[model samples]
Target: MKIEIWSDVMCPFCYIGKNNFEQALEKLPFKNEVEIEWKSFQLDPTLDASKPQSTIEYFKEKKGFPAEQASQMIAQVAQMGKGAGIDFNFEKALVINTFAAHKLLHLAKKHGKSSEMEEALFKAHFTDGKNVGDVEELISLAEKTGIDNDEARRALTSDEFNYEINQDIQEAKNNGISSVPFFVLNGKYAVSGAQPAEVFADALQQTYKETASPFKDLSQNGGASCDTDGCSI
Candidate 1:
């Protein structure tokens, strides 16, 4: 079974959803058979990476939210994150383009370190307040996640994984996904937003049951010779 999660490092709910889904995985009986793939997403693709701005300012200036309202909003998200074991420092989270981070994620995916890379990126952005768009910082994060530093450097230096990153985004669009923290279970079950762990667990259990071996094809006959209502003789 495959569970693909579309998320952006800048999304507070994405982090919470990740935590919830991981927790859900822990209680799942078929967890070992399930593979979790983290897909790339960018909250603000047009933002200039060179100009660093705090997340608070981004919400205030970019979104045109009042200071008090923005602070309250961040506080609400922070409280939710704390409940899910995340320490979100929205006050200092630097707002920058995540395209490079997403690119590095694809490299990590090749190494089977995509989840690790996602964790490192989220920690760097939400907790340590690092600029995620910087290549040097991304290389360091990749290294921390067990990706070779030199290889990571090369992948970042060149325009690598840009297509994969865009493809993930396009896939999301094709799937009618208009937001981050969207999860697709077995390519059939769609769970949106940062739902509770129980919700995730339920979705997993349901999908597993629906696709379980009990429903396997056991016919001796091939039953594979028909096309356009014409049987292959």
Candidate 2:
């Protein structure tokens, strides 16, 4: 089965959802038959890449949230991250445009390393506090994911994967997906948000059953058959 995940690198819940979803898959019997495709989504595409800011400051100035409220929200998300085994340091996280990073993700997808690239970007933004919009930083992260440095740099420096990124975004919009961390299981069922592992496991099993092959041959002994030789018993 194929699972397409729509997520943003800077979204805390996306990272948490990824971990939880993987945990769910680990308990499944047909885990090896699963294929994951990471789709691109930007929470704030209008964010200026040149001016990086802390999450608190971004919330305060851009989103019009007061300092106290922003801090509280961050605290809540951090606690949730802890439950998912993610050490989210929002204090150091810089909110920057992830368009370039998304392009790099397309490049990674071409090389079958999209999962690795997505994980790296999430950790860089939520844990390591790196500027994901920066070309050099993106190249470095891609390199760690086994993507060639020059190829990564070319992808970032040029507009090669912009169409793929935009297509993913457009597809999400058409599908009425207004949130990150949305999971499409086998293109049959949808699971939204950072749901529990049990939820994912159940969805997987249910989708598998629904989509599994229906034919089953039951033959205990050989029967009479006719071939080029005319007849057999």
Off by over 4 Å in 2: 214-233
TM-score of each: 0.91, 0.91
Model 2, 1-233: lDDT tens digits are 99999999889999999999999999999999999999999999999988999999999999999999999999999999999899999999999999998998899999998888888998999999999999999989988888889998999999899889999999999999999899999887899999988999999998887778644558888688999969998
Q: Write one digit per residue (lDDT tens) for candidate 1, span 1-233.
A: 89999999889899999999999899877899999899987878988988889877888889999989988999999999988999999877998888888888899999998888888889999999999989899988987888889999999888888889999999988888899899999898899999999999999998989878537668887675778879874
Could you tell me how far off, in angstroms, the CA of residue 218 lies in candidate 1 after the best superposition? 14
Q: Candidate 2 at residue 139, lDDT?
A: 88
Off by over 4 Å in 1: 214-233
Residue 92 in candidate 2, Cα distance off native in Å: 0.4
The Cα RMSD in angstroms, rounded to one decimal, for candidate 2 relative to the true structure is: 3.9
For each candidate, the alpha-carbon lDDT, in order, equals 0.89, 0.92
Candidate 1 versus the native: TM-score?
0.91
